[model samples]
Target: MGNLLGNWRFKEPSTVEECDSTWGSDSESDEPAAEDDSGISESVSPAESEWPPGNNGDLSPKLTDSPEFLPKMKRSFYAARDLYKYRHCYPNYKKSRQPNEYRNLRFYLNKIPLVPDGIYIEEILTRWRGDYDKLEHNHTYIQWLFPLREQGLNFYAHELTQDEIKEFQSTREAKRRFLAAYSLMLDFYGIKLLDKSGNVARSSKWQERFHHLNESQHNYLRITRILKSLGELGYEAFKAPLVRLFLEESLHRNTLPNMQHSILEYFVYTIRRPAARRHLLRYARQHYKPAHAFLWGPPPKRSKPKSGDVGASVGAGSSGIRAPAPTPEPQRRGGETSFIPASGCSGTLVSYHDATVCQDVDAESLNAYTPLGSSMDGPEGVFMMILERNNYSGAVPL
Candidate 1:
């Protein structure tokens, strides 16, 4: 029975020891176990372990006795195991955050060899005015204007001729819309109106118009609008004249303090350039005490209650002139203080309540094919190819 059991163990190997004896050798091993001089078993070297050294291996400490090595080795082992186990989880993991469509369009626009001479002034004007289709193309046309302006086309201002300006000045029916558009464009570009002999003509005419309109108590809103545009443009030559006008108007005793405050705020905030700022500041210091106080001083302390009245309760008919019931704070108009204009035209006062008048265009939308760049056949094809390569499935309704 002992002989039979021993033979069965050799053949079937029920225990680990029996299995080792059956297959593994007790001596004459293919690879010998390594030992240190102290007779301690040593770990297999990475090379002997058949593990490829990772890219970061060169940055690791060479010393086998390093305290950091154990943690690093464990991390590497787990990372490798995880990577192997989950390799199929992220098939499309490596991709740029920015879409290829936008990248291609930006590249094409920025790297264009030449802006075609075929892009004429008339075409640019038509685009600016949204002359193609009023509803569908207006927003697109407006969007294109900024790019055109950035490219230094100056199409808006370029449309106005000396003849047109003269006609606009002399004729009441010379197209009010055109006149308004040209005025805005001229002011935006800081173009000083010049006469046939190249003399500055518009300054005196504008000043005379301002005085005449002021006397009639009419078109004050229009005048203020023009003044605001002129101030914002920071026409260098007009700085001194504007400063004088601002000081004279703002310092008048009859002018409401709120109007003065608005004017001062406009100068301080709107005209951003240094020269304009200094010009406004210099005159404001010399001529307007209220403006100076408003700009520099702490807000007027609310008329403080008397020290005697600190803890005292008073009846409705108190002896000390009770501060007229502090006027209930004016309900803010559309989340902003509406500035009353100098003319007290509350109706016409510009409300700065809507902060997002001009919003950022979506990068994806801007990168889509437009009339301006669609004319470029090569770039259009390349843009489409890039879109396809990126597996983009969105419809572009260009």
Candidate 2:
């Protein structure tokens, strides 16, 4: 989350410094701008770089928060890394890897916490559960507290492996700690993980919690990392709705400002529903930063067949990271289809994209939804009609 030297290689969860490299990098300099379906004219890509907080009045930069030591440690870490890197003289030289003690995923399951005076994950869950000041200010504790399958910029943690996940699940106490960690992060984001249904809902403190969220500089990045960790570490079902809530707040409620970049880049595509994705994308394009061509680069043009060979198109979405819709088309139609949301689906849409019970997607109100067939004529409801349009199964609540 800090500055780097040599060729810029910003980690995925890095801070705005990574985004500071000006646009028009060689790859994007000659790229053409095009209009999305929303009719907005711009190259389709995620935001160029996360602008540091000062630009937006909604988020004033916090001059101080992370204890002086954290940034000092980060600076020293980078400096030491460069000293040993010797990039120009020994580009191919391999340096012996030293095992970082803090890198271990299992270490957090123990009672100890990060930092000299940091609180344990359990304490963070209990005593600090509602403590905004401490939670907002803490920096290094996050990566250690909520471990992830993906390695973040925090050098303190190691790469999360599938084996580690299985080990985590098998250990009862560890599982409890991980679940508690989830609760702590969710509550901080103003969401409540329901006990009976195992779904997430708006917390009574959403308004207050949300205000605190906007007040801080780094919460969006934290939210980005947290969402990725949840989706990866077996809480996949809850991931979708948390994303939806942000999209709803920023796009619909107008309550969340300057968040268009995060929502579009990290949140929208996680939704597997074509209709919902398109609906949100179309509306969001106007407000969001023009995505880099690298992100929304042109779909490739089709090539004519030469002999038996077929030419591939990178621009045709062949090289994209997007997963194809699980059920791209329905084999059978005119049958009953349902939109049951998984655990985190209350008051939200239902689909593995993290939709909820039919109750929220009531047939009465869902009639206006365009994903459904035009008739909307049956008692089976609007979701039933929407499901007819795809190879729709249903959400199996976990």
Candidate 3:
């Protein structure tokens, strides 16, 4: 996971605006909120610094300290995870662009612009608008840029009212949808919601593998396999696989051990978002509970009454006794487990067991496969799957 982070290069979107600007065509009127830099500023001078710090001026905008903001921050931070790679990969495989086309792209990207260090979107907008002025706001352009802008807008839309949604949607409806989807993704990733006090009102409980649908890694490979089988895979394809995997794993164990139990607990037990709370509850309700199973083996023979058994009731000795039948066991509340690397910090080793239900499998006795020589921190190791021992770069015991 850490390796995945290091390899990430932030992408700046191409300045191509779509020609089909009909969707959210309203003009911008509200003053764009000024960028907040109180926490960390680009221009801090050592000579004027104070330890605890005091107000330099009224430059700081009051920010809502809502705990819900953390996931937004996280999403905005991580959204760039695929931008650079996607930009590079697409041009090579899809089609070759003409030289002028490339020049047009570079112009839109503002290859030369005086962007201020502290400002993010505002700085980019200010410097690049000149180069971007003649560009059309086309559908293709929207599809690409929407994902980038969605991260920030999604974080802010929850606070909006119906009127605000309508007003905002007039110019940025796609932006709103992007935010809605992003918020769902962030919740699934297990980032906790906070209150004013900064306590964990809810903690993120989903594994990183489940949330990162794009990356290839051992834990995610199973999910991807299932997804590709379904055809036309996307983020939504992971939902069923994730749910079913948890169910099967939970039922296989007689008793869940370790913090593994808490993984499911946090996922099911916590309420991080108000709107999707019902959806999560409904999905979680389908897991774990006992049902009757037929017992089959040798049949019992009827015993004949002896001389002393005459005092007993006629059927007592002859008939089989019907003791109270065993009641079915209730299912565990959740079945999720944490994944650990089989070898080094990168090899994939997966084991599910309920020690009381069956014998525990030792890691040493398990088979291992090392392929691709991916370091624990490498992309292949972190994002792809290795199910069997022969699948890896080297032979290893599971």
Candidate 4:
């Protein structure tokens, strides 16, 4: 499964802003990136060139995500999964004047920025994006797709900027493609987002993908970055159900073992919506066992369950005929706690967790996780920065 890739061609729009530099407009590899670093500044303006091709003015979610269209899309993704290569990448690495400041911009617009691994944005979306093996085994792609402010395991992917975030948020075409990226990754994780139905649910591939998820490592961080980026990019409505499904498998069905900590600390805490966070916390409180009491504050005072009630019913079939002794409660981790990672840490972790759900996060605290000095225009300078700093690069696994 880790080596499987689907062969889906990038369907080009009728027009593009930057000379239509999209996959349809150019070869998988472009000219040798100019070796000079200083020339890669904002030589070209975004208004003139840095937008991805328009959807031909036809992005009415209704038609694109229709019942008729989705079946084809699903087939397209899974058709060659059984036969494609495990890993496909650029033939060689190249550096040019396309600065890191415009990395997300150029990639989203299908313009001139190649990721640190030298893979073009269009190529990843075409050959590797739908592949289960490439998505899982290829460690560098996630950083380019769901980029975070922090230092990821891969030093190759670019850091994000505030200006890039604001512009990307406002660009309609970028948002559409971002959602496409989100959908592909969700399919890999066994959850499917249904735009036509206006809902999200487990896909037919759920069981197998869920199994692979439990057996893997470092996905909690990936998930946290995804959840955080979704909210940052104006997709708040999508986080809850995805979180609920994972929690259900882990806390309810016991299918995803030893991941309760990662789900709560990393994935759940990264949620930006206040209402959704509270709802998920309440749901977790309902499903989590008494041993995990530290997670959602103290349990309501314990009393023996009376016969014929729901509590008594839950106890009767849970392992033995008789209810067992309750373990003493563990104290909750105080709010505003920073979970610095130690060597050989088991569950994936976030840098911080706010036990108090209603508290407001300051701007710096919001980005307290970043390791780089900041986003830069020159990849040459950033590559040197990556080498000079060990605090962030060594802190977490990709």
Q: Indicate which candidate wins on lDDT.
A: 4
- Stretches of candidate 4 off by over 4 Å are 1-100, 196-198, 291-294, 298-398
Better of 1 and 4 by TM-score: 4
Instruction: Please provide TM-scores, in order, for all candidate models, with all chains considered together.
Output: 0.24, 0.46, 0.19, 0.51
Per-prediction tally of clashes: 0, 15, 30, 3
Give candidates' CA RMSD values in order. Answer: 34.4, 22.1, 27.3, 23.8
lDDT of 4 by residue, 327-384 (tens): 2111122121123222222221121211111113345433433332322122111111
For candidate 3, write residues 76-111 as lDDT tens digits: 111111122122222222222332222212212334
- Please identify which of the two predictions, 1 or 4, would achieve the higher lDDT against the true structure: 4
Reference-based lDDT, each prediction? 0.26, 0.42, 0.24, 0.45
lDDT of 1 by residue, 1-398 (tens): 99975454212212212211111211223233211100001111110011123354321112233332321211111111111111122221223333333211121133221133233223443343423123112222221211210111112211222232333335443233323333333332223434222123234234433343222211121223333333222222343444345455546532322233334433332232334444454556565542322231111234546778764533221211122211111121111222221221111111111111111224563343222122112111111011111222222111
**Which structure is stronger by TM-score: 1 or 2?**
2
Q: Where does candidate 1 have its weakest 10-residue lDDT segment? A: 36-45
Highest TM-score scorer: 4
Clashing pairs in 4: 2-133, 40-97, 52-109
TM-score of candidate 1 relative to the true fold: 0.24
- Name the regions of candidate 1 deviating beyond 4 angstroms: 1-263, 270-276, 289-292, 296-398
Candidate 3 matches the true fold with a TM-score of 0.19
Error of 2 at 80 (Å): 29
Looking at candidate 2, what is the lDDT of residue 381? 16
